[model samples]
Target: MGLRHKKASAGGGHSTSGISPNSTNGTSGTSPDISENRPSWRRDPLEYNLDRSWDINAAPTTRVFNLTSSEIQAAPDGVLRPLFVINGQFPGPLIRVNQGDRVLVNVTNQLSNGTSMHWHGFYQNGTNWMDGTVGITQCAIPPGESFLYDFTVKQFGTYWYHSHFSSQYTDGLVGPFIVHSPEESKIQEMYDYDQVVLLQDYYHDLSAALLPGYLSSGNENAEPLPDNGLIQGTNFFNCSSYDSDSGYACDQNSTRAIFNVAQGKRYRFRLINTGAFGEFQVSIDNHTIQVIEADSTLVHPVTVNRLPIHVAQRYSILFHANQTTTNYWFRARMNDYCFSDQNPVLDTDVRALITYTNSTSDPAPTESVDWTYALDTACEDLAPSSLIPYDPLPAPQVDITYPIEISFQIGDFALDKAYINSTTWVPPAIPTLNQAVAGLQVNNANFTTSGVSTAFDSSQLVIDVPTYKVIDVLINSLDEGAHPFHLHGHQFWIMASGAHGAFNWNSYPTLNMTNPMRRDTITVDAFGWALIRFKADNPGLWALHCHISWHMEAGLLMQFQTRNDIMRGWAVPSDVLALCHVK
Candidate 1:
């Protein structure tokens, strides 16, 4: 992986890697000295523009955007810090493109370090190289380099893009992506307005600065607890929580994010947990939330007062403003049960103001109360069986079953790292994708016909399918902490999951063939198991890994090479191949 290097120069001169956003090399690097030397291909970051008025039935077209990644000075929740943003905006631009359209997003790396973006839930079927995974598919885009991610929107629903590098997204490299289609017309009528709600656990310090200590040998998987939480890039933090000598600037009167609602209107809130860790229970005082979508799959509406959302998961809820004209609290509570310890400055209950009037100055009602349902001690997702996809597509029959045992063990150096079965993943100099393409094209012996190939390094646990096959993956978690496993290219049908000892093979034939919950990310409870199945119709290297930023860095990831018959003829584009020469 090209992720271990640092800036070539510490005492900043003209950076070959590109200038920081807050440095003398301003937003566009307009200075006379650097202008001529700057790459003309580099462009500014894109601005988010999502118009609800746009016709969902409009003809599909190409959507082009230029995104520049750089450092910026900002206060997401009134805590001033250096944030990595796109176009100088926190929580990068929202990408909205209609279904069946082509999206050409050119990303320019202006940060002093390298980074790559992963489209959270898109099945990059034919365009696997454009999946933007830092190591498994391609190397990290070098500093000051540009990579054009050209892919077609094959599915319609709520999705997101974020830096897939080690703990990079934890620092603030995230934004929402929405794909519209004519199928949304019926659901569009169910809500008066639509909005994107982002709920994340906020940290005052950059993740890069904290990585060293967290990875130290003596640490026992004790993750750094969040100092606060944010709802859509803003929140209220108590300035007095830190003393004057604490070296942190604080504002006592920090404002909270406010959403104004008209009386009797139903608003659809697209909730995404972009946080690296922490599961949240989100709700509005006195309002019943009707969940219609989960990870882009529209579900039959189910009403609840509070909804539990884990890391890398999403849900769209409809709430009607049937209460009286007044201000109410929209609360997001971080479930601290999952953390080994708590931070002194952390206020686990994060709230925003939901006002009926345009004047956000209206004070929220103090008498508001949280829902009576108690938060669970275990970190998990909402029950999968409870959600039924509106479209009702049943899962196909399984052709192959891969039973992966997930556990953690101290390596030879006494450093704890996650392992899938006997092998733990570390990025190779040449990506698995590049290696597969070259080997398959030559009809190498490693490209076996039996659906399992050992062509990659021994440290990687890879399953190779030379042809299309339906896969049943039994992820057995042997660790104490719960894991949210996210598959890169396809949404799998979650056959079943629980904190049981192990999956009974006798129940395999008895599994339901009717509609089951299908999503890209699913949580496997501690010392438990989950059986998920997906059609391995996509061609390319797809990663199945724990979504927790820390767990992923601990080597808790594996890859699947599907449809090698199709990949054998792939001619990897020149620009994608250029990244391997970064060092």
Candidate 2:
């Protein structure tokens, strides 16, 4: 299977005025699109081992990416239908390692279509060449070919990886990559249990997959209905489905989806939001998640019943399931409200199960469960910098990190249309999204963006910004939905965010220089705006946008170029730049 250039799709296209529709009317139902009622996803696992190789051609095929679920699925179900997985799982696989350990992921694309992998939120460090960005840092490895991604695991905490080229992640192509603290040997005795719980939303209506086809087709009607929430892949209880094909009822539950736990143990729940475009509020049987880390950076522990995460963000929480009973139910939910909508009554709550004990019930339906994982405490501090291998260089000019107004003035989703530089935005033979990457508003109003990626020249930037140079950004959305904007290679502190150009910068606590949590992504409110900042340190072309694949494929992205160390000079490798094949 091959990656095709953007073209007209059966789903829909983008239009210049507003969201237009083709086959999907944003409403799907034998009845009216049920905004209140929803679905039950399967219990699944997102796990995998890092496959390493110096020789790409000789890479071993031990199924590097393992989607810990126990479901039976076949890839390329028909002709070019990709299964949204690398090795038979929604989230491609899990990559785990110890701090300071060298990491190498020999990606082998065995599925039916062409794809590219992203090391989401991972500090590219000295290995800027390995940071995954299709058609920019490097081109997608063609089918029948493989690539060896080698890098050292410098930072510890929670991180993830996903598909970068297209919206395959929406169909379920994602996974977790964990780097344990070098201090793990000492911290091991602090807890008696450890488990990873990742959350993600899915679009199971296979035939209706949209947005992506519209990248080139410009058809808005083809866009699938907005699917707002999701549960952990491994939490939904085993629900039996009835198949009339053979006039029989059998258990169709995936074997790899079930989880086992003990009654008394101090467990660590590595919480993640892999939502291509959703924010989730997680709960676990009425228990508050004692959060230990944010975006993989350790912080003073904080506790809360619920904490929200945008696309590509991660959290680590600790809990003691020391319940007297043998079983305890756990749940996680994604709300309809984001910076955009702030209150989308139309959004549904997503649910999943977590059992503290496997003991069975006496064949009777029973109680309700409500719980969420969150930070236990917080402090003013900055994470100690790891010994990144890059040479120290001079910093770039930090001109005005001034605020920019957002205007979702692009094309309509229902009609294949758009505008670039105030003119109609047309798809390039090889599309370059820069022209359409500014001031995106989703629903024909003043809105904010979570974050979007664009490109910039090394020459046009301000160098060596003085200390305390604050950059304020105003994102406006044109669409009715929210977008989680993430910045590659850097972390920004939140200033403020709200729908319709509203913000509370003076009221919110400013991130202190001490104990600052490094993050890669921050979600913009639905039809809202987000105010965030970070020291412009890293020098490279970075992407900023919603983690949601479909929105990105549409146009919710842009770029930034920062020179943290000016003396280091432009270190992007020669061969890696060639890989991008930029004319």
What lDDT would each prediction earn against the true structure?
Answer: 0.79, 0.45
Clashes of each: 0, 117
lDDT string for model 2 (1-583, tens) is 0011113230112111211111212111111121122222221232221122112222122212222212234321111122455454444445655555556566766545555677887767666557776633456555555666766665666787876766666666666777665344444444455555667754433422455464543444233433334443432222222224633222333221223445555656777777654456665564556766667655545766766655677777777655555333444444433322232222334544444444333111244445323421211111223211122222223335444332234345444432111222221322121111121212211111122222222211112221224344455544444455677766665544554456655654442333333456654543456656665555444565555565555444555544323313334545443433433
For lDDT, the strongest prediction is: 1
Whole-model lDDT, candidate 1? 0.79
The candidate 2 region of ten consecutive residues with least summed lDDT is 19-28
Superposed model 1: Cα runs more than 4 Å off: 1-50, 361-367, 449-452
TM-score of each: 0.90, 0.66
lDDT for position 361 in model 2:
30
Off by over 4 Å in 2: 1-82, 88-90, 183-190, 205-208, 212-223, 226-257, 336-352, 360-368, 371-399, 410-479, 498-517, 564-583
